[model samples]
Target chain A: MEIPDKSATAPDFAEPPVFAEPWHAELFAMTVHLHKQGLFSWLDWTAQLSEALAAAGKHHTLDGGDDYYAVWLDTLLQIMIAQGVTDDSSVQAMQEQWRNAYVRTPHGKPVRLADDGAD
Target chain B: MPHEHDDHNAHSLLPSEPALRVRALETILTRKGLVSAETLDEIIDVYAHKIGPHIGAKIVARAWIDSDFKQALLTNAESILGEMKLAGRQGEHVQVVENTANIHNMVVCTLCSCYPWPLLGIPPSWYKSDAYRKRAVREPRAVLAEFGITPSQTQSVRVWDSTAEMRYLVLPMMPVAAAGCDEATLARWVTRDCMVGTGIPKAPQI
Candidate 1:
């Protein structure tokens, strides 16, 4: 079955507030700025995002726009890896380090990375 | 002894997956020189305080104060906004809807979260959720009630599901007392939910 083009229909949207985390907007602007800066082309970004969306569609029912950025970040990571901007290992390393940090933090406390200790 | 440490202390931690992902992406991009730390800092500054619904409030404030602009915004948002840098990126094409004593407008992206980023920054979590997308069209009255908005029986709700190409913003009715208020003061009456058509502009403080 072909993927239904969502942009075709202009259903009346609702009053969901703009309460996304500041980081969400940060990630969004960062990507847009990079696209503008020509680190990657718009076509390239869209193609990746489309492919990501199709794959996501195959896996589960999409929660409308809820996971849009999650898919977006996935596509971005894939592209960055493909372009050799950074290696997958480095990405994994960072993820692991942060996960470790989160696993140790308490509820409502500011989670922090240990100092580089190079000092 | 310092060299023995591996970029972390035993007790320290990160807060969440998203925090990790954002930081990791930033680190990678900065390391590769694809984007500068300054660029990130500037964008973050805007995210923290400047962009998002605040821009929309400013636009609404302008509309409230200027009849011609209000007309332009209602008729052809893209054409009017095209003159300024405000209509870029996700806001390539926007159609503004007005909220009067009779009609109320709201926006959603049933397929994806296609928001007017240039004006509203990133969308709030609730706007991007499936529940709102599904229910917004089916039971707008209930949704409005959830937001503490109880429109009169004569009031009609109109939802605009934002697509990848175009988006929408609601022009909430100007409060009666807002007539003489300055732009900033008037803008304060415009909440983020008002742009989504879920809330109404409040009167200036007592």
Candidate 2:
């Protein structure tokens, strides 16, 4: 199957476009999905994110880059942990697994949990 | 999990840490049946294709032609937008501020990038930039000038700070050259910057 070139069709704007990276869009979609699943209310999500931003603001400027979404990812984890949806250890372990999987997968291939099992 | 790497070149292909982290989170959540990949794809598709400034422009065009809609939009935008099936998620609470002869309105989120996503899609990078967030509230006129909009000295600039609680969309004044034009034509003149108060619709050439 052939994939269309998204960059070729994207509109040119004076400034950088939102969702500069695919993961940014994925993170946003996951938050919305989790919110829709009754994991947390939108208000709660915003409050937690607001608090996270406030805390991060003290240490560095929020430039809406990886750092901004890093705070978002942290806020999401914090909420999930606080709500007993998932524990810190499990997430950490899973992250380690993914890191290993990513390191084993070849270039331009999708990283999968099964790839981690090859070891 | 082992830390052994079979492919040395794979290290160079590793995505950013946050990228890997998000992928892990999604994988865990999906395995636990908390989130469906299809739903995630649907949401991303909607934002990337279906939603954008074009929707907001259509609404603004209707307001430009209809006095009653303009009044209803300003008075109670949430319900009005809900009626149009445009109310959701980031647009739960909305306020439409009008630009007139005497007053000019601009929006920024001092806390974070809180915007009316259903109407405007994802915000522009500049909107979420540190410089814009800090300067927009401090000196809106100068910021507007940077966007090539120099609101006359007679006009008072009102900078609204958006929060997750409420989002603001600027209703730019219709250009004189657009008089008697249809709603579609008027909408063509309304750009994302116009709705964000950084730019105004230029007069359409006949």
Candidate 3:
């Protein structure tokens, strides 16, 4: 694939990237967050999820989009958080801590925290 | 202690799950030394894209639109990600790389498919290609050029080789038209391959 000139473009703010755990663990965590927030009742999430997975199964045996599902699950959690679902203290605490620790950073020039001056 | 060393040795002696799986597969191809790499590739392909990139795309999309949130994303991706609580499963060292005019960056885990599932989601197919991994560092411009991204002569292309300890995701620059768009709408323009710096965001319709 020919790489396009991204310099011609401006930066898009996708979710900031952070590395603390594995993808599936993140997926699982998001799902739990959703449940805690009550965006989707445990029963409803399981049902809709199973249905989506099942539907995905007919086309591709492996649910390759498990990460996507994790995102979908995360989206649900965000929606619930936005919608004022459960708001369990544990979930709120986690979100708060996450917000403080990982999410908030000064924009521009890629925060220099990770890069040590020395090679 | 020596006991710890011995335990480490014992653990090392035990084959990892992926190693075990590979060996099991090799056993099936025992007659032929050339095991079809495609088989393993296929499996990884399904997992990386179907599950990984899909989740990542959402994170990237959301960051593009939300300012206070975008600031949060850039400052400390891991912990902020912990808010979404989606860090850690396969990709533990997920790092975000923001693309800029003077320079362009992309990531490649040449050794393995280490990725930032919590943020960018699953990686794309070309990300795992030998051609990309081998040449990205040596000839980044050419490699990215192949993907339709041509950085200026003055622009320095830095390729971050991903490792188990450090993975990368691109905080792709937002499109000009994305000014008033909602996160979900803007996400439509953030393609998975683009997040990895292998492609550009789709042009807005006139």
The candidate scoring highest on lDDT is: 2
Global lDDT of each candidate: 0.71, 0.82, 0.53
TM-score of each: 0.72, 0.86, 0.48
- Interface Cα root-mean-square deviation for all models: 11.3, 6.6, 20.1
Chain B vs. true chain B: TM-score for each candidate?
Answer: 0.83, 0.90, 0.70
Residue-wise lDDT of candidate 1 within B1-206, one digit each (tens)? Answer: 45744444444444456657877787667656777767867776765555667678778988999999999999989877778677757335788899888888888866556677777777776675557766888998898899898888897888898766778888998988678776666776777778878878764342
The reply for model 1, stretches above 4 Å from the true place, is A1-26, A39-70, A82-90, A94-119, B1-10, B15-18, B182-184
Residues A1-119 of candidate 2 have per-residue lDDT tens digits of: 22233432233234354578888889899998888877777778888887788788788777777778889899998888888878888888878888777686677776677644332
Q: Higher lDDT: candidate 1 or 3? A: 1
- Per-residue lDDT for A45-109 in model 3, tens only? 54454444444445544323333343344444444445554344535443343333222333322
Docking class of 3: incorrect
- lDDT for position A38 in model 1: 77
Two-way DockQ contest, 1 vs 3, winner: 1
Instruction: Return whichever of 1 and 2 wins on lDDT.
Output: 2
Candidates sorted by lDDT, best first: 2, 1, 3
Please provide, for model 3 over B1-206, each residue's C-alpha lDDT reduced to its tens digit, 9 standing for 90 to 100: 34433232221133233222223323223223323444434444444434445466667777876667777777777787777767665435466778877667787765434566555544544554445655778888888878788777876777888765567777777778666655555565776677787776774332
TM-scores (chain A) of the candidates: 0.68, 0.78, 0.38
True-vs-predicted CA distance for residue B22, candidate 1, Å: 3.6
Q: Deviation in angstroms for B62 in model 3?
A: 2.4
